[model samples]
Target: MATKTSLSSDDWIKAAFRALSSGGVQAIRAEAIARDLKVSKGSFYWHFKDVPDLKAQMLAHWSSQATDAIIAAIEANDGSGREQLRLLVEAATDDRNLAYGGVRTEGAIREWARYDSAAAAALKAVDQRRLAYVAELFERCGFCTAFSRSGANILYGALIGLEALASGELADLRADMLALLAALLQGGDSSQA
Candidate 1:
């Protein structure tokens, strides 16, 4: 039996992240987290009203860090739209770690969103923000409105695909991204060019 002890809300949140990352959202159990933290289940109740509350808190935490932060930084950068778009591609592709979550986290959150209404709504908000950021960058790079929007969709799809491929041996998709970036920057109409 696990010993009863004090556990902070942060501890539960961290455990929730690990659980979600490893086994998807269904793996998040207050009891499991309490055990992992070497505390009584009461520790969890002290921080969260119940499992549903814990799940909501965890999803919000993930969305804020994994989606909002990345989009905000890309939007805030003082560079040309093309430059920002290129940098965003590099940031999303490069092995160089930064103060953000990876594509896998995004994938897991997407899975969570499929079954949870609140998670789905959060996912929609994150997607809208990310698309807007990408569109802004593309527009700044001189692409037309339709081209920018289409480019955002294409780039996002490519990123998710590359992330899945990265789990195998297809090392880096940087070259492909650069090629796409070059074309977009040159005003290659994504629809017909």
Candidate 2:
């Protein structure tokens, strides 16, 4: 046995992320990552105990980044409750292209969850935080608790649907959905002043 060669976690992470995002969670193989980095499997093993270990670390990293965005945006808003919520919704909807616009891990994760409890758990946690954030935004904007919570779910669902559709005929779908959501939040119906 030889001492494992040195390699940065970031390099492995980048390769892993690209593989997952481009293909799916199933595509995240240690051998593939090693190939992507032009390194030996020892390098991946040196950083991660196994594929599951890599998945766990990746999920944790994604959760932190996503949660931080929500927290930071709220902190920076510093305005009326409605205004703050507005900014959050905007931020949540901003740049659909970068936020899994044309592609998504939804289907992949759903399948993986059958055999991968860790991935399932990670997805559930992320979704809870997302729904809670949206619900808070709706509540701050003076909506009733029940309606706000339900609406938050609806809003999130719509976002995901639009993201899926953005890959096909609904190319302009994101813009349309954003406009509709903004209007509703601003207290204007589909047809009103």
Candidate 3:
């Protein structure tokens, strides 16, 4: 059990994410999270000004870890764009990406966005960033601008839909995504096709 003095802001954020994953945004109450963490509410206050502050910090942390960090990791390797695209799909679909306590944090956050404007905005920003990056990868793979954008939209939309599906229902989403990637790459300049 972590004592109040030993708890960090990251601990509070992670606890809040777990609460959000299990029970939605309303479950992210500081007191509830503190109880879950076996710490007092004062510990939460020590790291955040209030619940809203924690919520803001939580969104920022999620964005940094879930989006920015993944992109950075994918870029660190000197693979070709096609290889990077495959890596991106693998990384995105990897259970370790957003799974927390067997729940998809991305799904939870998307659900939270339905009621929270901040969450919705954050989601929109993340989506745009992802789409742009995917499109850039396609461009690097010799796709035209329009084709690259369209491919990014199709691939990203499918990914979001797959994430919403039950795990048992997805026979092999990663393979499906890779198949889609191969098809897109084969199309090779949609305007000419």
Candidate 4:
């Protein structure tokens, strides 16, 4: 239990996310998070009805923060479809571009989805929504139906790869992503991975 402190639902959620990232979904247990945060389990119950509730909220938070919020922001901004695509890629790789930003651990969440039905469903919805948005943008940019879909898939897959596998400094990865994005948009060779 946290000594001499008060914690909100958001605080518990943040701690849960950290736990999830470092120790996988199993680490999201309420008692574990409370211990990690040095807060009483009562504090957790105050915010969530139970572990399942927290998991549901956590998935909802992940989807909204990582997908819905980002898409809404990009759509609200004034820019061409291609420019929006660039921004989308930028936000995915670097949370600094977002207003409601925090440490991103979608890679861990994706791994969790492999074992948990709720997580899997949430991830599926996010994937479908995000891909649909990308396909729409590609269409707006004048890509043929097949090409636009292929472009969306390729772009989304590349972003996921970077999230899961890319190494090196943040700056280097960002630069490399930009180069890859350019090549992909131009439909040029990108076999140098």
For model 3, how does the per-residue alpha-carbon lDDT over 74-167 read when each residue is reduced to its tens digit? Answer: 9997999999999999888787644243325778899999999999999999999999999999988888888889999999988877766734
lDDT on C-alpha atoms for all candidate structures: 0.73, 0.67, 0.84, 0.76
Colliding pairs, model 4: 1-38, 1-39, 1-40, 2-38, 2-39
Runs in model 2 deviating more than 4 A are 1-7, 93-107, 186-193
Model 2's C-alpha root-mean-square deviation from the true structure amounts to 4.7
lDDT tens string, model 1, 155-182? 8877777776764547466777777677
Q: How close is every model to the real structure, measured as TM-score?
A: 0.77, 0.76, 0.89, 0.85
lDDT of candidate model 1 versus the reference? 0.73
Clash count of each predicted structure:
0, 0, 0, 5
* Model 2 lDDT per residue over 1-193, tens place: 2234556765676567767767777789999878877777877878898987888887776566556666676868778656765566566555532433123544344456667788788778878988887777677667777767777787788766765676455645546566756756755222222
Q: How does model 2 score by TM-score?
A: 0.76
- Winner by TM-score between candidate 4 and candidate 3: 3
lDDT of 1 at 174: 79
Q: Which candidate leads the pack in lDDT?
A: 3
lDDT of 4 by residue, 1-193 (tens): 4542467676777788888777888888988988877877777888899999998998898788778999999999789888988888787778542222233367777888999998999999999999999988877677776777888888888777765555323434456677776776677223211
Cα-based lDDT at residue 28, candidate 2:
93
**For candidate 1, what is the TM-score?**
0.77
Stretches off by above 4 angstroms in model 4 are 1-6, 96-104, 167-172, 188-193
